[model samples]
Target: MNKVPMTVAGEAALRAELEQLKKVDRPRISKAIAEAREHGDLKENAEYHAARDQQSFAEGRVMDIESKLAEAQVIDVTKIPPTGRVIFGTTVDLINVETEEAVRYRIVGEDEAEVKSNRISVTSPIARALIGKEEGDTVIVRAPGGDVEFEIDQVQHI
Candidate 1:
């Protein structure tokens, strides 16, 4: 399988969730299942069925996280030498050429991309255009709305 690029922080977040699900949620569901089983026949036990469903979901999540971590290639942007070029895990400041509006975005893994948080997926159109570009460089993104031009004001490794 191809390695998936992920920021150190993104990997850490996934690890944290995995640990919580394994140690906390898994055990909690197990207890619930056991308690539900104690309530008598399993055929009519709604609680047991619900608990089993929860267990299945949690187990699936654990497997997904495990697989993702196994294939993840963590990149610590702070440790990389500052090349002034945009890359995964780098926070970039951009100015919309047409509107002159300033915006900041951090290029992150697909799992961590949250537009509200100004984190964009590395595969996003803007991020793809920004990658390998240096500060003061202008980039044009083919956004779904339309083609938008941006000026790279700064790039920070954080």
Candidate 2:
């Protein structure tokens, strides 16, 4: 499996989730399954079916998280050298040339991309265009509506 890029914060979140699933969710589901089995008729038991479904989902997620952690390549943004050029984990402020609308986005790993928080994936079209660019550089991004030009206002490492 290929190594997956994840920020320090993202890694922490995943670890916490994994811990919760193992220590809490796993035991809870086991208890539920035991109680469901005590009801006796497994042939048409709704409780058994529901508990089994939950157990399947919980176990799948535990495995998935473990796999991701095993292949994760955690990146510490603060340790990277500042070159005034955009790189992974850089927060960039941009201005649309045509619309004059300003937006700020932090280029992060795929796991940390959340548009509501102004974080975009590094592989995204806009972030790809902005990568390696310095302040005041104009970058054209291919969008669904056509190509959109954006001027890099600032690059902040946070």
Candidate 3:
């Protein structure tokens, strides 16, 4: 199995979610299933069918999380010596070359990518363009809107 790259924080978050699924979600679904089964008439019980469906979804999610954790390569940014260059889990500050607007993004794994949190997946176009780039380097990225240029202003490990 190919290893999936993940930051320490990302791995922790996934583990936490897996724990919640196994401890809380799994038990809740199982209880619901038992309660529905107790209602009798399994052939025509809508509640039983619904509980079963929920159980399927919860179990699937738990399996997926476990698989990812098993194959993950956790990288702790704090332990990595800073190189002043962008890499996986590095937060980069950039200025739009054309508009001169400042923006920041932390390169992370695909599973942890969240625009709302300013996290971009390492495989994403923007992160690909930023990787290995040092401060003051200019890179052109193919964004969903169009091609955009950004000048690296800063790179931080945290």
Shift of residue 9 alpha carbon in model 2, Å: 0.7
* lDDT on C-alpha atoms for all candidate structures: 0.96, 0.92, 0.94
Please give the clash total of every predicted structure, in order: 0, 0, 0
Off by over 4 Å in 3: none
Question: How would you encode candidate 1's per-residue C-alpha lDDT over 1-158 as one tens digit per residue?
Answer: 99999999899999999999999999999999999999999999999999999999999999999999999999999999999999889999999999999999999999999999999999999999999999999999999999999999999998
Worst 10 residues of 1 by lDDT: 80-89
Among these predicted structures, which one has the highest lDDT? 1
The runs of at least 3 residues in candidate 2 whose Cα sits more than 4 Å from the true structure, single-residue gaps closed, are: none
| TM-scores for all predictions | 0.98, 0.95, 0.97
- With a 3 Å backbone cut-off (N, CA, C), the pairs that clash in candidate 1 are none
- The residue-by-residue lDDT of candidate 2 on 7-70, one tens digit each, is 8888999999999999999899999989999999998999999999999999999999898889
Model 1 residue runs over 4 Å out of place are none
Please give the ranking of all candidate structures by TM-score, highest first, separated by commas. 1, 3, 2
lDDT of 3 by residue, 1-158 (tens): 89989999999999999999999988998999899999999999999999899989988999999999999999988899999999999999999999999999999999999999999999999999999999999999998999999999999999
- Evaluated at residue 79, the lDDT of candidate 3 is 90
